[model samples]
Target: MTRFAVVAMMAVALVGCGGDGGDQSQEAAPEADAAPAPGTVTIVEPADGAELDAGPVIFVMETEGVEIVSAGNMDPGTGHHHLIVDADVDWTLPIPNDPGVHYHMGLAQTEFTVEDLTPGEHRIIAVVADGVHIPLDPPVADTITVVVR
Candidate 1:
C-alpha cells in the first residue's frame, strides 16, 4: 500500500466518529493545497433561496480540485465535505459534527439529506475541510437558504 493509503487506513481506525456517528476531526493541519485548482463548493440542488414544504431536504454537492476523504487524514488537495444547516461556519476551527445541524461526510460522500426540519428559513453552508477538519485557507464555502413551510 502507498503511504497515503496506510495513513488513511490508520485514520479510519483512530478517528472513526464521535458518539453521534459523525466523523469528527479536531487535530488536522491548517489547510489543503494538494488539489490542482483552488477548490469550490456549491449546492447543485434545492437552488439557493428556494422555498419548499415540510419533507426531506436533499442536497447535491459539487466539488473540484479537492478530493473528499476521511477527516482524519491531512492529505493536501484532499479533504472532506460537510453541510452546515441553518447557519454559517467558524473557519477558524474544525467543523463540528453536530449530527443534523453540522453534518460531516466522514467518508467523503458528496450528497446529504436533512429530514423533518421545523418550518422556518434555513441556511445551508457547504464547507470543505482538510484531513483534520480545518477549513481551507481562505475557506472554500458556499451558502444557500431554503424556506420551509
Candidate 2:
C-alpha cells in the first residue's frame, strides 16, 4: 500500500512539471570544455636584483596555461598582466592604475617599458588578472627587485 501511494504521488508530481510553454532553448552560458588548469607567470628580463641605468627599463614576461586577455569573463586559462612598480601589491582586488605604481597592461601585453626611474632600488611585481582585471583567486604573479643608477 505504501509503495502504491508513493507511485501515485510521483505521477501527480510529473504532471505538475509538464513541459513549460516558455522558451527552453535560449542558450547556455559559456563553459570551458576542459577543466581550468593551473597557471603561472614570470618576469623574464631585467634579471632580479640587477642594477641598471635609471632611465627606460623594459620588462619581459612569459606565461604558461594563461592567455593575457583584456579583463572580462573567466575563460579558464586567460587574463591580463599588471606590472606593479616600486611598491607592494595588494592582492585583495583588481590591480590599480596609478601611473607611479600600478600598471594595467590590458590587451595581453607581454612586455612593458618604464621610461624613467629615480636612481634607487625598486621592486617589480607582475600579476595575471582575469577579464576585468581582477587577479585570480590564487593570484598568479611574480616579483623581482632591481636598482637603478
> How would you encode candidate 1's per-residue C-alpha lDDT over 67-122 as one tens digit per residue?
67777888777787888887668888988877878988888787888876779998
Residue 136 of model 1, lDDT score: 89
Q: Kindly report which residue stretches of model 2 are placed more than 4 angstroms away from their true locations once superposed.
A: 1-37
What is candidate 2's local distance difference test score? 0.77
Residues 6-64, model 2: lDDT tens digits: 99999898677643311212222235575654666788889999999878999987776
Task: Give the 10-residue window scoring lowest on summed lDDT in candidate 1.
Answer: 18-27
* Model 2, residue pairs in steric clash: 71-131, 71-132, 72-131, 72-132
TM-score of each: 0.71, 0.71
Q: Please report the TM-score between candidate 1 and the true structure.
A: 0.71
Assess the local accuracy of residue 73 in candidate 1 as a C-alpha lDDT between 0 and 100.
80
Clashes of each: 4, 4
Stretches of model 1 off by over 4 angstroms after superposition: 1-37
